[model samples]
Target: MKNILYTVLLVIGFSAAGTAQEINWVSLEEAVKLQKKNPKKIMMDVYTNWCGPCKMLDRNTFQNKDVAEYVNKHYYAVKFNAEGNEKINFNGREFANKGYNPANANRRNSVHDLAHYFSVRSYPTIVFLGDDSSLLAPVVGYQTPQQLELYLKLFKNNGHTVFKTQQDFQVYAEAFKPEFTN
Candidate 1:
């Protein structure tokens, strides 16, 4: 009976692991270099350490199996700390967290230049860039796996280009049948 119980536990563990999505997160510079080698859209998760919704996004939406797999396969995922002290260079310009205070690393610090450039006003903004490093969109706030799936599919499949108006997107969203299980 003990052996059977152990086998069942092992099976359940493996099954859970299989369903969990493992994301390969990279830095902005690394993602950009990789994009030059092989062109693909970039998905940047701009977040702050003190933001509760940002943490929830990391815990829920980013951990979703289908969302993770799709993002991993199609987009170069980057996790950018909005208040971090990291310097980033792109397109002959340098972006840095100039106002970052070491004393208050956990609390709200200075915003990164990149975040300012993108005009990110929210806690957790999912910024998508085109293959050529063009700004596609900046989606703000905490989005569920099912909610984010629509954007993922829209950008990955060039649905955004096709969606010229608000009505077009509304139609698409209304008709989209999400495959992600929560």
Candidate 2:
């Protein structure tokens, strides 16, 4: 009886894990292209390889099934390495990495100009932008899967323009009830 119970639990766990959706990460250039076509908002995960919390965010928060589904549905998600050499053009300006330290022991890459443009002071900062590439607001520090979901829905549903304060958003969020079938 105990063996059977263990087997059932294992199967259930694996099944839940299998149902978790993968994040469709698009390139900065490709994201821009898609934006022109779809005109959806942008969610950029600004990260660095050497950052521990960034890895945790990718594995824990981003891997959540709801986070993946909601982001894929509502925003063009982009994973950007702050120290990468890739060139990006935004708002008639070209941005590139100017802070790379090739000789550093940890191989820390230099921060890109765009990171500075966004005023990113830490790793794993999630920046949400409007359809026209304007800053909507950035959620700094680490967030759990559930915490991240609230912000994802808030931006996706155009809640920022309506609610002005934390209390207002909390009231609005509490009122929201989504029904998902199948």
Candidate 3:
């Protein structure tokens, strides 16, 4: 009886401590396959190992329980290293970084061919893709969980399609109420 009480107490203590949850990130090819099976939007974190904002995005936003839980539930999360050497098969084509230097793997190596294919001009770009794997938008730079939730809910609900002009989006942004805790 004492052992059972102690075990229950331990479980309650751990639950109250609130262990961090992580977004289940899959490869680009895996994400594509998953999309065909389950049909969720893809949220690709286009990042480099040397990028500070990329690290901050991982720590500040991605690690947040609310953000991680919502993303894992609504999107097929992908971590794409902009300077990676891995060959990625996407949209019926293969992409690789031909000029990627092994010695500069941690530094600013050549950008992946897929990054150019997506027209990513900045680091830590959160590239959102449709269920059919078409590019929806590239949200560049670090974003707080609250800031990112606006994009998340908008894309998940296809709110971008209703926008006839940039002002429409601006109005939506102005009226947006973020539910995620920062």
Top candidate, metric lDDT: 3
Question: In candidate 2, what residue range of length 10 has the lowest lDDT sum?
Answer: 173-182
Give the per-residue lDDT of model 2 (tens digit) for 1-182: 99999999999999988887988999767877888988988999998878899999998878877778878988999998887777898778899876666675255767889999999988889999988778998889787877777778788778899877889978976886643222
Candidate 1's error at 54, in angstroms? 0.8
User: Over the full model, what C-alpha lDDT does candidate 3 score relative to the true structure?
Assistant: 0.95
Off-target runs (Cα >4 Å) in candidate 2 are 1-19, 165-182
How does each model score on lDDT? 0.92, 0.83, 0.95
Question: RMSD of model 3, in Å?
Answer: 3.8
Mind sharing the TM-score for model 1?
0.90
Ten-residue stretch with the least lDDT total in model 1: 16-25
- Please say which candidate is ahead in TM-score: 1 or 3: 3
Instruction: List pairs with backbone clashes in candidate 1.
Output: none
Q: Write candidate 3's Cα lDDT for 1-182 as tens digits.
A: 99999999999999965788889999989999999889999999999999999999999999999999999999999999999999999988999999999999999999999999999989999999999999999999999999999999999999999999999999999999999997
The top-ranked prediction according to TM-score is 3
Backbone collision tally, model 2: 2
